[model samples]
Target: MSDTLHPLRVSNDALDDGAELRARMADDGYVFIRRLFDPDAVLDLRREMLQVMQAGGWLAAGTDPMDGIADVSRQCTEGDPEYPQVYHEVYKLQAFHEAGHWPQILDVMGKIIDAPVLPHPQKIARLWFPKFTRHTTPVHQDFVHFQGSFDTYTCWAPVGDCPVELGGLAVAPGTHNVGAVVDHRFSLGAGQLQADAQDVPWLTTDYEPGDALLFHSLTLHKALPNLTEDRLRVSLDNRYQAADAPIAEHMLAPHLTQDAPGAITWDDVYADWTDDRLQYYWTERGGPVVPRDTSYSDRGFADALARAKRGDADARLHLERALRRDPDSDRGRQAAAALQADEAPSR
Candidate 1:
């Protein structure tokens, strides 16, 4: 699926030039910087994350955890029941959360935003398994998921060297210039939604450790499928915005905490943390918080219900996940109803 890929324009040359960085971000909707972070630091964090996975039996026996040799039998994603069991353990890593606030990233984001920047509290990590191409992240604007301001930026960086076969992110340059959210439909991908981004030229590269791809919230982007035989593709998906810009209320919590089966809480995440400095540090910072718009997800669910009625297997799986995640929630109840309707005998 990554057959047609162009090299991203390297923006490290303008690292110190705020005017040039802002100019390029305005023109291309993204800034690709090679080795944006210290390679050793990235590797250190990768070791920490993968070790947690290894402990959870997600990695192959006798293999070094640092190699990220995934046990494909344990291939489950965010929506799957098994994912949270291990993911919540990884979430407790202090280093993992600290990586989101790395000074270099903050510095560049401030320059691009032309204001003091706030690294979003709900930091995310994509721990993708190989041979799981069907669950690869789909094309869509970040606004559909992170909703706050169109000025919000997602800074994605791999935890280790990520070749094309390992599946990193790619962007359709200047797509954010559309200046508005486009139509999205149900998807079995990470976000459970996909935007149609056909016929557009895609830009990506064989990303090395510390390389970062920063893009606007409304930019069209997706992950290239991981086609490797055994390795897991791990990456950071942290968001940032002007310190005074509005933020969605959900962005204040730990990422995907509500979506996790038992619903992970900040207290659970901080119980073992040795440092408390970053804990709730954003409470006094950031701009006014606003409620999240549910329209995007509401439409996606509607699409899934229709598709499931027509016997779409992926749609059925998505709904099944919703039901299993929280049967008492409103969406979970709707999923149950739709599934029951689909299973009813034809009259």
Candidate 2:
């Protein structure tokens, strides 16, 4: 007996601007589909992905082969950000934003989730979780670094059917309105992370590929473990917005570095952002930063940023670790000084 309304499909049981589905999302805090992809599209996407893995030999969190059609494009990798698996060569592909690599994959996600978000911190990434390992994403909201309101829903669309034993996503229902954060210093990896089990009831989502499971930023979610036999799970997680909701990039700023080296112009990416339609959306959110330095290390920064956005106090420690790793960075130095000052009183 669910109390919330789900965002059900309009004409074909396929989810649209339906009231029930929206209600489900608003009340329950997540809307998951057991399966949603056409076999053909899933097959094609997998084939293309394989080509990318074969070509790049490695990939970072937001990189994919489709984005690397160009001779000198960006590619994702599992090695340290500073010294990737292949240290000498710069593999971060510039083509991710090019709109060619896995056109079908992105397009389908857009149609389903209604919000085709950029997967990369910079844009939608074709991340390759390290072999024999899975990413340990903790429970938190996606609104901070992600552009737009916290109401945004994520559609984790894996390429294959994702069963619980195969590294599915775990989420706490009816927790979307749980402020921007709570306490979680003791929480690590999976489990409640200092939260009351009764306060937030989590659902283990066992979904299939060609389909997606949606969750709000405040849903208190984490990536499930992948201990399946031989087969690995892959997915294309997209975010959706109500038709009236503005595009994500419009809300989050350009998500860019000041450097113009491999920068892709917004003018070409999409048309509307230039006229300050974007400026209006970010009235309080602020605009893209003219990164004083691009040498910022991401190792622990992603976790720290996610934690800070969720209002976790201890996230500062990871932030400090990240800054220590990025000695020659403006973002780092400022962070270092702030971290030292914050800890000064206790010492």
Candidate 3:
């Protein structure tokens, strides 16, 4: 792929009609809205998150919270037992919950999904530390992970200013039409398809607070690695779908289970909340639950894996093809493991 980055065409909220916005999403598999929420609100959440990080000894002692300066010496390597503990704390903040349900965000989601929408209760917060290449999210589609309605949309917003170098998201335009790709496991706890990104034009921009990207569930997207050695990148991933649509059972669960070490119970997270309305909102409605499509063979992934195991010269290519065809299947995971071993250096 070219080193040059292409700016995603921004949709002006005032100028774009619902039809126009929907058209943009259908064409690009995502719509980038500039200043969709209050910038100050976003920064406030950033400060709140940083305070939590500071308490966890993840931030530099003297730096301003808004700066998000990481304590390099104190950084915990990936898979460290304490790492998930810190993430669990970040997930429990009131600010985090409030931001996920911000009114403006829901309004936009309503327009896009064209129905009553319920934002998934389990929100994801990404904290990207500088120079941590393994921490960068790999290129993957969200549909496999979230097997709810195919119409589900993910709204990603930076909690603070995210320059391109700060590792904002980059998406391959119109990749949703390609359907689910076979995905291999990567660092950063997400699956990555091994297909060359050069096959599609990638779009990204310097994201300011309030700017948000709403993408289709199957869109191919990835995070740009944080290049700055001192700064931290913080962002939110919140999903929304039509209320009548069947949803995966896991989407309603808390982000960190109570069983996980250092996880706070949902009861404790809601204890001080003044608004009782937000609690158990989805369950009270009794929405339909749907089983996620976890089968990968319908896309011929099994055949591809069989060919690869036969010592085919194009084994890697076959695996990539399998992933592109049915990323949600069990075969996709097997294909990923085979590809990982293929890439590993010999002893």
Which predicted model would earn the best TM-score? Answer: 1
Q: Lowest lDDT 10-mer window, candidate 2?
A: 287-296
* Candidate whose lDDT is highest: 1
lDDT by residue (tens digit), candidate 1, 120-207: 9898999999999989999999999999899999999999999988999999999999999999999999999999988999999999
Q: What is the overall TM-score of model 2 with all chains considered together?
A: 0.55
Error of 2 at 72 (Å): 25
For candidate 3, lDDT tens digit of each residue in 133-176?
65467677787667777788999999999999898999888988
lDDT by residue for model 2 over 127-232, one digit each (tens)? 3342333234456555533435555567666655566656656677777767664444333332113333445545664565455566776676666555543343
How should the candidates be ordered by TM-score, best one leading? 1, 3, 2
Candidate 2 lDDT score relative to the true structure: 0.45
Q: Which stretches of candidate 2 lie over 4 Å from their true place?
A: 1-17, 59-79, 82-135, 179-199, 228-232, 242-325, 331-347
| Residue pairs with backbone overlap in model 3 | 181-323, 181-324, 182-323, 182-324, 295-329, 296-329
User: lDDT of each structure?
Assistant: 0.92, 0.45, 0.75
